[model samples]
Target: MNQIDFITEIQKHEPKMFGLAISILKNRDLAKDGLQESAIKLWNQRDYFQKVKNKQAYCMQIIKNWCYDELKRKVNNHLRLQDDEEVEEGIGNEKDHVNDTYRRIKSLIEKLPSKQRLIIQLKDFEGLDFEEISNALKMEQGSVRVNLSRARKRLKEMYLEQENKIKMIQNEE
Candidate 1:
């Protein structure tokens, strides 16, 4: 891609990178820093983009790596701030259900092994095909699909269990 194409690519994916970062880091400021670093890294390797079969996926992989690094750094540094916060307070009541679901999903995602979580996020949330995810992850296609499927199944079970517990609690109430 050329100069204009590169700018457009950045514009298209900037939000996704930021969102993914925030999902993993749970801090807006830290997410922004990770996005900035990813953008800089992409810029430095602009020429290498031509060789990539899927640039967006490649950039997303970069962002994913940065997020994992940030997560490790924060935990290793022993930060006391709770990872969960009430950031959805401004979304209004109408979106509360969806936001709650997302928060629950994020919590589930957090519990996943990093490899499984990465596969699920790339395949499910990001809407990438197996081949694309495999290429981005540098893994075989079958491995990517297996990981994604397992992650989704586990998350589904977890959500169902949580739902049942909530229902039981409500009945008790």
Candidate 2:
């Protein structure tokens, strides 16, 4: 796309892109860096990007790929990030319950198979429709729906399992 079109497209999806980065990286700083790097990468590939039919989906894909790459690099290098702490510590306050629920859901999401987790993030968190998610992930729309359904079911099962364990512990105590 041309400069104006590219900039417009990126800006339109910037928030969602950043959200995707945050979901994958789980760190604001790394998300920001990933976003910037993705932008640079997109800019470098502008010529090829010009022929892309779904610019937003393409952009999202780039962000997702970069985040995964960064994660793999960290793991390969045995790099420890400060933000990799467990979320079990109660943030203890008025919002503790809400925070805890959010953390628990996020933790469960991370447990999902990578493709299913990514599909969930794209559809639920990024507010992308099945077709959009399909384009972003290069999967068929039917496949996208199937993956989302499976991810939701898995999340619900996991949440209930965790709740049951917590309840049993409380009862024992």
Highest-scoring model, TM-score: 2
Model 1, 120-150: lDDT tens digits are 7666776667876676567899888788888
Overall lDDT per candidate, in order of appearance: 0.77, 0.85
Q: Candidate 2: what lDDT?
A: 0.85
TM-scores, in order shown?
A: 0.74, 0.77
Off by over 4 Å in 1: 1-3, 19-26, 68-84
Residue pairs in collision within model 1 = none
